[model samples]
Target chain A: MKAVLGNMRAELVGAGGVVERNAYLTKRYIWWDVAWFVWTVANTLTIVFIAKGIEATGGSLDVNETMTTLLIGAVVWAYLGILFEFLMETVAWERWEGTIEYTFMAPLSRAMHLAGQGVFAIAYGLVRAIFLFCVCAFVFFSLSIPDAKYFPAFVVLVVASISFIGIGMMMSVLPLISPEKGTQLGFVAQGTLLVVSGVYYPVSVLPEWMQWIAKVSPATYALDGIRKAILEGQGLSALWSDLWPLLLIGFVSIPLGLWVFQRGEQYAKRHGKLKRSG
Target chain B: MTNIQQAAIEALPRRTAPAVDVRDLSKEFRRRDRKLGRFAHRKRVALDGVSFTMQRGETVAILGQNGSGKSTLVRLLSTLLLPDGGSAEIFGHDVVRDARAVRRLVNRVSVEASFFKKMSSSENLGYASRYYGMTSRQTRDLIPQILGRVGFPPDRRDEPMESLSRGMQQKVALARALLTSPVVLLLDEPTTGLDPRSKLEVQEFIREIRSSHDSTILLCTHDLAEAETLAERVGILDRGQLLAVEPADALRRRFGATTLEEAFFAATGRAFEADDEEDDEDREVFA
Candidate 1:
């Protein structure tokens, strides 16, 4: 028992190392992060303004309702996007720094190392997503809904992050196994997720085949659950349909993602793929 | 042998096990080979059935030309690269089966002083300490002490790694390796590009580590003088094979030569200056 506790303590400290090191790296690259933040805001605003654009075209509709739906889609997509990019970039950043060998050679377990990256990504993503939410929903648009259930929306967001992280962890191995075109492949995966997740529209509007794909995407349920929470004032018990799928995907995907990553890491080590960064 | 003879054999002063035991370890990498606009792949043997052993508290240097499988050997033992054949053991722990135990005991300093360039040296070392399972409080005091011992300036500990000279970066690399218990130090061409002053400084620090820390050191270098002076045993590696491993003076005497450079030529039938091009860090690698 003492040995097990000691090992656990060591793993936790190692995970904290990953978080602290990344925080320092982010501090040095603060300006680049700020620039990316600005671009994220601009892109989200462009999507949200479609409702205003429709009103300008002489369409008779409930402007506030339309804006509220678009806003939820935009902000949640941005939130999901943050987690995706952060996790995917984990591999890219390690390769770019040319420290893949050192990081892999560390005494820490692979699970703990990845957990550190995941924890950091979730924290950082939440910060950016919340900021984007405030800037868009309250500041830029001044939109509000009566009887909104913020707590349930927050719960849905937390659960969805797990599934998102699992997918991201699977993507993280690409760069390790293929140094040349791994990042471009990650972008392709992200684009596919975006199309199938109903980020900017309802899943019912997508083609029947794409709707099938959306059923597997965590973002689909996350977006639906949060929208219902905010727009319909639904509580946790009422959101069971969306919550269970998210939970199922989270539990299954996390372990599968971890297994796939371990195999890819072993492949990298055997092929000398870990040595190449450029 | 009788029971009393067996008891006497066991009582004889003998090391229980070698600090590092490598048996027929080999690694092969596939490289892309293009002929007449057709791309094919070829398997390149980086380390070919190479074997050696290191005693505890011994400092050994491997002398090799470029692309001579030195770095590949180090990487394999460090657990960064998987071997294709045979096995290795560190302090009775198999590298493949007990890699965690090996990782805890070995630290490597490669040719390239790799780090997060934007982060300070202190931050980088602090990060490494945590990965080695050192607590924050331990690293808070240990990082500076190790950094200072390597002749690093205290004022520049907070400066970004990219801002420092290659020599300074090398010092930081050495410091990071020594941050843990000095069990086994793998120095892969550690002073390759350093100026003379920095080279001497690093060499002096290595000597200090051996004498004070009782650490087993594996120094791989192309510099003949550095190998002869800093190492207790100098090994000659050519192509993918270890030609010889013995004390420097004895190696020269065995080859009937004056200097280690001449001894290398006498043994391999090639000038020490000529290097193999088949196996190198920058060679084309394929999955």
Candidate 2:
């Protein structure tokens, strides 16, 4: 038991090291992130204005309600976008810089290095998402506060985020194995998810088949849980359905994602890919 | 016994248990591609029936061109990749059976060292120190000293890695490897692209680490002078075969050549410059 704890402590220290390293990388890329945020925010405003205009023209849209929902949804979507952008850039950038091979030679497990990339994404996502959300809400809804249900919603959100990022980690490993195909597929998948995950509107309105697809999407649970909590005053028990699917997704995806990453690493090593980044 | 058997028995290097032990180690990679209307792929033998062993604390420099299986051998011994047709052990621990133990003992320094580009060299080193189980205080004290020894200027320590030169970054990379003082140090082309001065600085640092620490070094390089200077025994790896492993003088004597380059040409039956052209082709895919 003591040994296990000691190992855990060592791992934590490694994690801390990665965090420190990534913070610097994040700082270096701050300007690019700011530019991306500007573009994404502009697109969000255009979306909100269109939604409001449609409601005014006998669209049965509650102006305030629709604005609130769209505002939060857009903010949440920003997180997804940031996550995808950073995830793709992580492997591709490392490979291009010829640093990925150096990373492979480190005494630490490859997964741990990968975990640092994921951590950077999560931290970047939180900052961008919160900033975008505040800007949208202030401009559109006069800073109308979310209700008390945010507590349980936050828990469900955390679970859903893990599963989503787990899937992203799997995608991230592609560039390491086959840079050409990996990058091509990474963009396609992220684009498809953005369109189908109901980032812009409710998943319920989609056709039955589409709804099934949405249910399987990690974003569905996250959005649904958040909407129920903050918008409808739902309690923690009300989030059981959302929570369970995410738990199941996380349970299955984390191990599978990690295994795929390890396999990619091994493939790189056996095929002499380890030298390319060096 | 005849002269051949007697010579083989007499010439075998003395080793209680080899620091690196391998037998019939072969690694085959399956290459997948899409045809006009079908998928076609084939297995390529990267390392075929390779066998060799090194004694404890020996510094072995492997000289091979691109696709000569030098990096593959390093990766296998480091337990990063599995062997398809043979077995390997590091200090008697099976690379496959005791991978965790191997990982703890081994440290690798490659020419293209990875760092958080935005972070300062100090920050990167601090992180590495923590990962290797060093306390923060130890990191604070040792990093600057190590970096200075490797020729990384103190003024540049706080700047982001992206701001540093390639040679400076390589210095920091070498410093990180020494920070742990690992028992097995695998260096894959530790000074490939550096200026001559930086190259010498790195070679000196490697020498310092070997003498100060009880680390067995496996240095893979294309530089012949580097091989002669940094390693006690130089191994010639050609087309996935270890053709010879001997001291520079012994290798030259065996091949009846004046220079290490001439020795390499005589052993591999191809000109050294020809391999440079071949490397140009190998480099195209990555670029």
Which candidate has the highest DockQ of all?
1
- What residue pairs clash in candidate 1, if any at all? none
Residue pairs of candidate 2 with colliding backbone atoms: A98-A277
lDDT by residue (tens digit), candidate 1, B191-284? 9999999999999998988887757899999999999999999999877788889999999999999999999999888888874444444332
Candidate 1 off by > 4 Å: B1-15, B36-39, B276-287
Q: Give the range of the ten consecutive residues with the poorest summed lDDT in model 2 chain B.
A: B1-10
lDDT of 1 at A233: 94
RMSD of each: 5.2, 6.6
lDDT of 2 by residue, B138-168 (tens): 6787888878878788887889888888888
Worst ten-residue run, lDDT, model 2 chain A?
A269-278
> Chain B in candidate 1 has what TM-score?
0.90
Report lDDT per candidate: 0.84, 0.74
The share of true interface contacts that also appear in candidate 2 amounts to: 0.47
User: Which candidate comes out best when scored by TM-score?
Assistant: 1
